[model samples]
Target: MYAAVTLFVFMCLTATSHADHHHHPCHSPNMTGFMSVMTLKGEVRAHGAFTYDSMGKKLRFRSNESHPVNTSIGLDVLMFFEEGVFYEIDSKNQSCEKKALQCSIHPMDIPDDAKFHCAMNLGNPSIEGEGFKANVWTGDIPGKKGVYSMSVTMGCLPVSTIYFMDSTTILFSILDIENEIKDPDLLVVPSFCQGQPLEETPEGTVNTFYNEFI
Candidate 1:
């Protein structure tokens, strides 16, 4: 009976660990609209306990590789402008051809309720998964170039955004109060995206390819 009980407990623990591993949300383009690219410089302070992921050969976020100093470190983040489009990447990473891979524009499919303006206010956000949630807030992030504030609730997680600058340059700052530091190394640039001159595809559209470096 003792041995049986021990086996049962071990099984339960394994099950729980497996369940926790599957919490990452799906990241794909769902919303559509014009795309814009820019670089952001700032300091990252882990307000709470956070862990960075360094696995995944592609799309890896390797925050654990180097222990990020608690002090202010110069940061360059790649920003993609499109409703519901968010990706964090090292903006200083360059391509072999000497092109700045700091950021890229990924076009999205527009939603029926999509609106183009300076502000959005969405209440009662929903959660998509572990470390993933859907949120809405209003701001002049794409146009007008003004400071706007927004709050989003994804799966009960509250996220806030502040639009600090918009003009010849656009800037949006995001703070995840309850952000779980899952591997920040998950989003490393693929080698194919590293360096290449402009080229046309068979579809007559221009796109860049990145190699798997993670």
Candidate 2:
């Protein structure tokens, strides 16, 4: 159980870095890594700004039609795994509705620390990507339940992504990864999830929107 929660938290939260503030790798592990796979559910705020091309003509702005990105809001995410299988919830809204559904674990990347465990110096490393440089700060998650926190550098980017048909058509993206940690008590499986481990996907999908806008 411990191992499962640990993996779940690290895996799901790690992938979120591309969305929130850009997180650079930490030079050292600040908190003791969890030995269990945890189920994490919490809120994160996403903020972004964009300008439509005038195309030499003024486009009238409509309040209803305009899908202005959230200046800041929280998100609820879940992490669960067992029997070598894993599951995650990538809800679009804090309310956890289907219509607001974002992405699932259909295909995601769980970075291989052994493969890319680049040691970062003090503070947070500056990871330069597209239009942002993720500033990652490694530390422990708040509360005594044993959690880790990695604050990504928001710099200038969207808070979350709005998915499209081809996965590349992202309407919004996460600005940074605020918090990540393990919770041994989150054992009950959510009815909306199915546990089945799948191959890891590329990180391009997570960063696609950031590259396009930033």
Candidate 3:
């Protein structure tokens, strides 16, 4: 689960450094509302909704992911992002954990085979699809060198509609849209799960979790 989410998030967006924020299509100036999004990557498909404010300080999401590794398992995730912290909800234990997803990378530490990947970028000026005109950007991800692309519509809402790793096409799209989110409280972790954060999920636990849910 950790590897799945981190791989999706960190490798996304334009090659432009994070410092050039205004140009990032994913960072819509109007992303501050509510809607449900569905994403399909590789063999995993996830559906969820989010509510956020304009400041980008708070975002709450609830989604279910496809079972890729084991057909018998299902994964439903509830997460909140604030400042630089990522909080994942463990409903079975009724806890909001902040440490389970932390990871670091050192380019020098990676083996040479892993370093052969080339960076991907927006192919050209974004193209539009179907009913309306939306910006489309394409880039490639390192997993077998897949080419990925996304589209953002009105209010700056975006989804990764097509991602091809090796020879497979992974898709992400918005299932539905609505204005005005009723529950503002969704932006914060539930009180029952608040306090000191839980420890990082151990590698063994991660393996077990994925074994059950992937």
Candidate 4:
């Protein structure tokens, strides 16, 4: 009886440990990231937390030596079905007149009902070691450059985006990617955001925005 009880207790502890390992809301992308950042101008530093997944992206950027001492935040909920083709939820990440007007680098207004934007092969993609990398051009916004990277390691798949800038480098990394995004509400814009149901695919709307420039 004593030996049996001890075995049962050990089994319970092992089960609990396994459950704890997979309990996070999102999966870590791969390897330890946001590790260190290096700039060409001899400035290197670490920043804040960043999270990404099928639902969206959230990042808090800390100012470095080259930048002003301010904490700026950027959150973008995104989805992708094809290569270089994805929908960036717009209500929270809005541009003027549904991207009708030119966007400024200095920040602009967020329309209550902004449609999703399509990001096509803005540029070509390349690979870095076991990861993937690409630099694309987005012409609707003021700046027309962006970067995307991805890697899968030890059952953790992390996808990241680094917006290209002549001045600064910002990275959006998604970690611990498990659990299918079964919640439709997450993909939907809240009523307060004033977004209407999309008529066609979100990718179609983004295509229209780019058609004007193309």
Candidate 5:
């Protein structure tokens, strides 16, 4: 259970980094898409549907995850930045765990300090088919011993992100993104999660993926 919870938090942190540049004309402040995450060492794998609302400071991730010792878990996390809390829900068990947000929530956008790596085509660009032209950015994770590389389309659609931390490598990929969130209540905290006492407060500076980057 501890491992599962840790993975859930890690996944949530990883998903927070998306594509939005103020200088760029195109940006995705609201998006819903499929997300897949995996570790290079094959220690953990998760895939799910996610909704991100940068304007609303909310996020929702419903995922089926497998990790540490081949345990499978189903989790739904709803994050509310304004409330400074997040709820971890187990739909099958009708249980919810409320926890304080360990790190300040920021918009799901590339950090301004991120260095532009290059602009390249993400796929085959042929006469009959034009591939996605994307900009790549790299940055060191603030207050953490890691670095991240992100690729996004010219229109500010997230393509992929790779985080290198210590000796572990994690990859995050998004696909089939819709620029508008379809479900109006997707970010709402479930009734079961209401009035629950905070279960834990994560300690350590390395708990967040984009800590202090803003």
Candidate 6:
């Protein structure tokens, strides 16, 4: 009886450990993906492709942004955290604007303080192999009065994110994520940006890829 009880206890501990491991936060630091932002009213604010290299502390975003008064514009933005600068390039007119990197950089990963909210299936969960499994996490945005939630696949691929800010609700959908950074050159600063004077912008007015989180 004693031996049987000991075996049962060991088995229980092993099962608990396995469950914890399965729910742990996992992410890929270097990846390329498509990202879109929309309002709660379903208006798409911007859609773009982005490449992130956390190890090198750099990111690139090619965005097609819609404006309330002006026509849609395509812009390419490159951010180098190590140099504390960012460049905005207008490809059509060959204009580049350089500015100081004012916003804090948030990594493309699950935050350490994020808590596991639930497990969900992207499609029909009852049907085997029909859809992918993902985990949802929620946490408060640091230094902000907001909550951020994200869903990621079992392989740590981001599916979507939602931000609840003071007066706005934004939804970010991530798709077609490739776990590898195919073009290392995408993070390089363009030659057009060289020797450009840094334009001074008001604080908290700089719109950046990572600014949505903070």
> Per-residue lDDT for 171 in model 4?
39
Q: Which of the two candidates, 2 or 6, achieves a greater TM-score against the reference?
A: 6
Per-model CA lDDT versus the true structure: 0.27, 0.25, 0.40, 0.28, 0.63, 0.65
**Candidate 3, position 173, lDDT:** 45
**Which model scores highest in lDDT?**
6
Encode model 3's per-residue lDDT on 1-214: one tens digit a residue. 3233324434554334333223443343323232222233434433445554434434454554432333322233333323334555666777655644222110101211221212233334355432343444444443235654555453445533344555444444443444345577676667776785656566543211112222
Clashing pairs in 5: none
For every candidate, C-alpha RMSD to the true structure in Å: 19.0, 18.9, 10.1, 18.9, 8.3, 10.8
Q: What is the TM-score of each predicted model, taking all chains together?
A: 0.21, 0.21, 0.49, 0.29, 0.73, 0.72
Candidate 2 lDDT tens digits, 159-201: 2212223222222222222222133223333454433235454
Q: What lDDT tens digits, residue by residue, belong to model 4 across residues 1-214?
A: 2232223323332332322332222233212223223232323333333222322321111222333322222222222222222233334445212122222111011111222122122123354354433211121233354321222223334333233344554433333334343343544434543443333434324332112212
Clashes of each: 41, 37, 2, 10, 0, 0
Report how far off residue 145 is in candidate 4 (Å): 5.2
On TM-score, the candidate that comes out on top is: 5
Candidate 5, residues 1-214: lDDT per residue as tens digits? 2233234334434554555444342345699987766665555456678898877778787764543323324757777766777777887787888776654322245666776665655346664465556666677766557877776777778777767678567666776888889996888777777788976654552324222111
* Candidate 6 Cα errors over 4 Å, as ranges: 1-24, 64-72, 81-84, 105-107, 201-214
lDDT: worst 10-residue window of model 2: 56-65
